[model samples]
Target: MQDDQNRLNPSPRQESILVCVSYGPNSERLIRRGWELANAFQASLTILTVDAQDDNQYSEARETNMSLWESLSKKIQAEFLVAKNRSRNVAKTIAEAAKEKQVTQIVIGQSARSRWEEIAGDSIINGILREIEHVDIHVVAVQREIPLQQEDYEPGVQAYLVKDGEQDILQFDPPAKDAVQGLFFQSIYTDFNNGVFKVTEPGKVTKYQIFDGTVTRKLSETFSP
Candidate 1:
């Protein structure tokens, strides 16, 4: 009876999870999924992002995403790591990080590439599997409902929003000292400064609608992508 009880009630298995993310709207969803798995298995979690380009060359959206990921990692008590990939092999970099961390499981978001692109090129999943042994990988499906398109907007620039009786005004030039500072992305299709306004603070991104150089809605009415 004692032997049977010991066999049935074995000690908990040790686990470590690694979450790979890129600069996109789905990154947060992947991180959250990894966190859930970590909690379920009582595993240590690490969030990793591999950058092929130098930090100085990162776009405004990439920089903002990195900051948000770091903040989220801290809030969730997970280690956040950034790997600079000089060779531009993202899969190899991820595998190396997993080995160093002794990760048993990895969580990654699904590729955004079209079906034809996936068939023409080697998948990152296959590459990671080739480099590692005895590790489980989870690929969360990408969300198709997000409406953000980074390519549609110009490069982000420092801007301000000033409250003018019942409305907010967007200004590219220097504004009063009390105005809020954030990055503004103007639409390439529009002649006026009309695009997404993103205010990225620690662990949060607040997005507002901009039309004709004016904020048209409240923060609560706008999306956070």
Candidate 2:
């Protein structure tokens, strides 16, 4: 709810996916699952609504027709897109949107699928897949998204030595301990992948060691100081 800067550009968008809803009986379930899936992959959702309408103006009215469903999507804090067009081109429009948004996946209503459809006469689902080059699609029947587990975890710090696949030379001066100086599971970078890190106490370097090619005694006798 904070400003854009506070939101962190939407979490790096692990995957860009779009969902299409035909507003059928199962539309609600697909949207709910899409939301859950987006959160799981850290992806974004685009809800597309396709109908027999001829233009985009009346699409708003159609959406208003489904205000209750929209409210449901909001309840789960999921992103959605609503599109309205002639049924003949609805699938195409959805595919176009998928490409434009760089959609990683597509979720659509059950009405678009057929169990034993053939290739010569591909189903709407197959047509969408065949045309959309880069996007993947996920069709959901029910609330397929599972809720994330909330737990309390204790975080600790650790360190690692990094190089361009080679040892470096530097006096074993401890890294900056004023901020997170310790052994952490995360990795830091150095010149050309040459770097070092250590775990410290009070978030300070409790114990540290380093050997870099750039300094005298560049290679220390692997000692834990």
**Candidate achieving the largest lDDT:** 1
Error of 2 at 148 (Å): 35
Clash count per candidate: 0, 25
Compose the digit string of candidate 1's lDDT tens values, residues 127-215.
Answer: 88999998999988875434564476789999999888766789878885678788998866445666778887766677876755777
Report the Cα lDDT for residue 184, model 1: 93
Report the C-alpha lDDT of model 2 over 85-111, residue by residue, as the tens digit.
544555576787787788878876554
RMSD of each: 11.4, 20.9
What TM-score does structure 1 among the candidates reach? 0.59
Question: Candidate 1: which stretches are off by over 4 Å?
Answer: 1-12, 112-120, 145-225
Off by over 4 Å in 2: 1-13, 54-65, 112-121, 142-225
